[model samples]
Target: MTSQIHVALRPLWLCRACAAPWPCATARLNLLAEYRNSHVALSIYLAGMLYTAVEDLYRLNPQDAPKPTALHDRFLGWTAPRAPRPQPSD
Candidate 1:
């Protein structure tokens, strides 16, 4: 019952970390741990809903792109279609 919901949402918890949602790492960790208790299941569900809203906001704002770095670029390159490079000019 509640356990099933927790299990289903475990990935979303990890996703929030990977996405680096607001409130900083320590605060997020505290929130997650607190929400794990059965008594706090409702809190967990609400947090998940809020996290979804945050992700939606991100999707809406292309200009607020995630901080770009070489590692991110490489990851994108792996997933994205590649174009042929032009030859060096003489």
Candidate 2:
């Protein structure tokens, strides 16, 4: 069987599938598995989401907002990019 969509719950920022933090343990595992061969795309997608989450979260705490570094690490800093593919020769 397939897994359900694991989007964030927003506001509270929990995982829709597991109810953990957004990009929670289960979501992270599934993301890595799905983009195992294409980490760049995953990075791009996460970066975009990070931007949106940051914006929304900031509106909620304009004075006590989390640091950019913290948010970056939480959203996009954990994973490294995928390795390059080998070229085929004739």
Candidate 3:
């Protein structure tokens, strides 16, 4: 079977393969694996994409621009390394 390459469709910010939002689940996993060694670099890349998404989405609907917090969570939040939960004291 042929593998689908999950990529951004641009302007629309949807996944080229799954038709989901850009940086869809598969794309996220691929990116995490691809940049496993350089998280800062990944953040920088995602930030740039966020900027472009904001511009494109806003232009598409200026009357209801995408929320900054939601976009931040979508583009960069998931990439953040979460801290382990603290264990209960003995």
* Top-lDDT structure, candidate number: 3
lDDT string, candidate 3, 1-90, tens digits: 999999999888999999988889999999999999999999999999999999999999989877999899889999987899999999
RMSD of each: 13.9, 8.1, 3.7
Model 2 TM-score relative to the real fold:
0.75
For model 1, how does the per-residue alpha-carbon lDDT over 9-32 read when each residue is reduced to its tens digit?
Answer: 232223333343333355434545
User: Highest TM-score: which candidate?
Assistant: 3
C-alpha lDDT of residue 4 in model 2? 74
In the range 11-65, model 2's lDDT, one tens digit per residue, is: 7567888787688877888899989999899999899889988888899888987
For model 3, the run of ten residues with the poorest summed lDDT: 59-68
For model 1, the run of ten residues with the poorest summed lDDT: 3-12
Q: Clash pairs of candidate 2?
A: none
Cα displacement (angstroms), candidate 1, residue 39, comes to 9.2
lDDT of 3 at 4: 96
Off by over 4 Å in 3: 83-90
- TM-score order, best first, reads 3, 2, 1
